[model samples]
Target: MCVSHSVSPDFCDKVMFLLAQEHRGPLRGGGGAGRTAQEGGGAGRTAQEGGGDGCIALEAGGDGCIALEAGGDGCIALEAGGDGCIALEADGDGCIALEACGDCCIALEAGGDGCIALEAGGDGCIALEAGGDGCIALEADGDGCIALQAGGDGCIALEAGGDGCIALEAGGDGCIALETGGE
Candidate 1:
């Protein structure tokens, strides 16, 4: 792997391990109440669960699959699942998420006050979203589709669907939108 800036030896080792286990097998985990689980698998198969305040979970599963989740106040999650798919989610105050699912799909979501999300689903699709005060979003669905959106005061959105379709929209003060569909 390459990076723009220098990294510590420990960071490099961790990154190497993560890359090396991309084609190993399957990994799964479950956390107890008010606990968090973090796991990494080989051959791209991983799953994890988290509960309680400020919890985080991360997993890489299946053929380049990954999954991650976080719960309670100030939570963050990241996951990559299925064939080259990834998913991330966070809930409660100050939440952020990033996810990719299905065949080369990515999805991200955050809920509650100050939330930000990015997601990609279906075959070759990309999506991003943000909610609550000062929100922004982007989403893409279907085969080769893309979308972006933002909700609440000062928002922007973009969406695309079907074969090579694109759409953009903004809500509240200062808004804009661009949309396209079909082949």
Candidate 2:
């Protein structure tokens, strides 16, 4: 087990005894909820969904989607393996989300904008808020380049990629990039 809540099953609340599964939220992502993973540390499985009453987390082999909120004010989240999302209408309200893709894309979407991320390959590319600006920014864990933000300000970039971003047009202008080694 890569990570566990307690020492033994007697006290373990969320102890993962597998290797083909993973969690991808604030617990490991940032501040989001409904964390999930596909190929981290767990036995091979397609969609083994589990959690608490308030948890809407799901997992799969192709993709994984986990919406931060929208169910209520608590922390409504969902995760899958093929897209990982809580679409606009389904995202509910006050939704915080963190998305990732093993192929070549990862995203964290919020209406007002309040999230962070850390991507791997992603074809060496990164995209912040597709609609607004970001709070804290830094992209330096892609291929070997840095990416640029859309058109706003405060968006930072380190060893990330700039496939589609405008200078000074992004958001945040934030972060001490090139220093850290992850997205």
Candidate 3:
């Protein structure tokens, strides 16, 4: 869904796109206002380029939101500015979630047999939660906060921070948490 520039600030609200197959190109959900949700095999670019003030939720094998590109059997989410929030949840044999933004809050949850949650925030905050047989959480960026939690077998958390990185893991399986500082 695309909104015109003349539209009001609250023009877009709670827009959702669901696809069973793969979505190529960019799938727009709101030009400058409202919430966007996409669920399916995934999408290449889920939102408008540059930046916009909106919320996005993508759960697919490709990607979600702005410039979101999810891999096979993966979920990706992205948001621009203006109190934007992005949440991605993947459920498949192998689930993966990817999120990025400078001022948006990103949350990724992957639940399946082998789940992986990856989040990156620029001057923002990211939260990654995974569950299933083998769960892993990876995060990177600066001036951002990352929280990772995994359950099941072979759980690992790795965080790379441009400013600071935080990681937390809990489960009965083998778990590892690693944090790295900026360069």
Candidate 4:
């Protein structure tokens, strides 16, 4: 099943077709002013958009669950589990937070002044964050974990455990701190 609010009919149809092909249950899309929330089940995917001063939240579960959000001066929070993947983009001054567990992957991009925080646990977890005049904090645990952060006039803090790897690249005035434990 597919549901869309404040979005074009063509977009709704395309989302339905894509969900059907993937055999994933349910797709919800919302746009326009105010806050929006999108949730999916059974390895599903969700996308949301919010106008000025509006926030968006997305959550999903099961293997291959994905969530994407875009907004302005509006924060975005996404949470998923079990091979979950999430991507977030924020315009203006807004923050993005993403958390996942078990083979998770997350990417966040912010325009203007904004911050990004990402946390993941278990095997093969990867996270990337990029923004301007914003801070990025990433933490991952277990094997094969990787975290990368890049920004200008921002600070990056990365922590990993057990066969973990972390990279940080900052342009202009910025600080980078990396920590790893156990191999």
TM-score per prediction, in order, is 0.62, 0.37, 0.39, 0.42
Highest TM-score model number:
1
Question: Using alpha carbons, what is the TM-score of model 2?
Answer: 0.37
State each model's C-alpha RMSD to the native. Answer: 7.9, 11.6, 13.3, 12.4
lDDT at position 16, candidate 1: 43
TM-score of 1: 0.62
Over 104-125, each residue of candidate 2 has an lDDT whose tens digit, in order, gives 3433443434433323235333
Assess candidate 3 and give its TM-score to the true structure. 0.39
Clashing pairs in 4: none
Displacement of the residue 129 alpha carbon in candidate 4, Å = 2.4
lDDT of 3 by residue, 1-183 (tens): 332222223412412332222244343454433433444433353432222322223332223334343333433333233234343434444544434343344444555666555454554554455556566654544554555556566776545545455645455646675554544
Candidate achieving the largest lDDT = 1
Q: Whole-model Cα lDDT per candidate? A: 0.59, 0.34, 0.43, 0.47
Q: What lDDT does model 1 reach?
A: 0.59
Ranking by lDDT: 1, 4, 3, 2
Q: Over the full model, what C-alpha lDDT does candidate 4 score relative to the true structure?
A: 0.47
Model 1: per-residue Cα lDDT over 14-119, one tens digit each: 4346434522433223545544355545644555666555445655566555566666675556665565554666667666576666554545676665666766
RMSD of 3: 13.3
Write one digit per residue (lDDT tens) for candidate 4, span 29-147.
35543334454454345534333444443444545555544354544544455453443444556555444444434433444555554444544454545455556644445455665
Candidate 1, after superposition: displacement of residue 140 in Å? Answer: 1.7
